[model samples]
Structure formats: structure tokens, C-alpha cells
Target: MAAAASLSVMVLLCLAAVASAQLSATFYSRSCPRALATIKSAVTAAVAQEPRMGASLLRLHFHDCFVQASPVPSLSSLILSSPT
Candidate 1:
């Protein structure tokens, strides 16, 4: 199970790198002007409250992507939904 999860993460990371390469620097500027700043502030506050929260959040994201068996999940959906 651990190895499978790790492989999933590796595959996703590689796909993300390739997909990100096609995105423009200002891709979200017109669609969501404050998106980056909002994300940065939220992450900064979470990490400041608990340094380990950063890694925990990342692990949760990966788990959401690969561990869920029903109702296919996507990173954007996970980000928009309640963390609990």
C-alpha cells in the first residue's frame, strides 16, 4: 500500500510538472486576480500556527488524490472542499 501510494505521488508529480510548463505566468491573473496572494496568505498563516501543518496538508492532498475509492477526486476539488 505504501509503495503504491508513493508511485501514485511520483506519477502525479511528473504530470503536474509537465502540465505546469504549459501555463503562463499570468494564467490566473485575469481569471482570479488575488488567487496567488490568497493562497500564500492562507498557507503562511497555517504554517505559522503550526509548522507541521504544511507537511500534513500536503500529505492530505496526496491521500485525497490516490486513496479515495469512489467519486473521483481532483486537486482543485480537494482545495475547494472542507479539509475535514
Candidate 2:
């Protein structure tokens, strides 16, 4: 009985992993840490180039991260709208 239970659990886990493997086009960052730093620094330096663009990108990333981390759509949207 225990062996069957474990096997069923393992099968479910494998299926879950397989189901989640698909990713959206935008999430492909070859170097995530470097990309994050680049985006942050670009915004920080945007006091000169495109002021609003930097801020907008930062907000978009923050929101993107939140949704990816937490799939509860309504909660993510509400938090995204709230003041940063």
C-alpha cells in the first residue's frame, strides 16, 4: 500500500512539473541577475535619458515578478495598482 501511495505521489509530481514547463516569450532572460541589475541601474540613471521610461520599466518588472511568483491573478493586479 505504501509503495503504491508513493508511486502515485511521484507520478503526480512529475505531471505537475511537466505541466508547468511552458513559459512565455518575455520570461527568457539568459542572465537573470545581470538583467535585473541592468534594468535597475538603467532606471536609476534615467534622471538624464528617459525619465518616465525607466520608472515604467521598473514598475513593469516588479509587477511581472509578483505575478510569476504568485499566480493569484486578482491579488497580483490589486497589489500592482497600489502605490509603490
Please tell me which predicted candidate would have the highest TM-score against the true structure.
1
TM-score of each: 0.47, 0.28
Per-residue lDDT of candidate 2, residues 1-84 (tens digit): 556555655676676668766665556366463776786776678756866876677677898776567643343444455545
Best by lDDT: 1
lDDT of 1: 0.75
lDDT of 1 by residue, 1-84 (tens): 556555665676687678655668899999999999999999999999999999998988888766775454565554455333
Q: How big is the positional error of residue 2 in model 2, measured in Å on the Cα after superposition? A: 22
User: lDDT (0-100) at residue 41 of candidate 1?
Assistant: 98
Clashes of each: 0, 0
Candidate 2 lDDT score at position 71 = 41
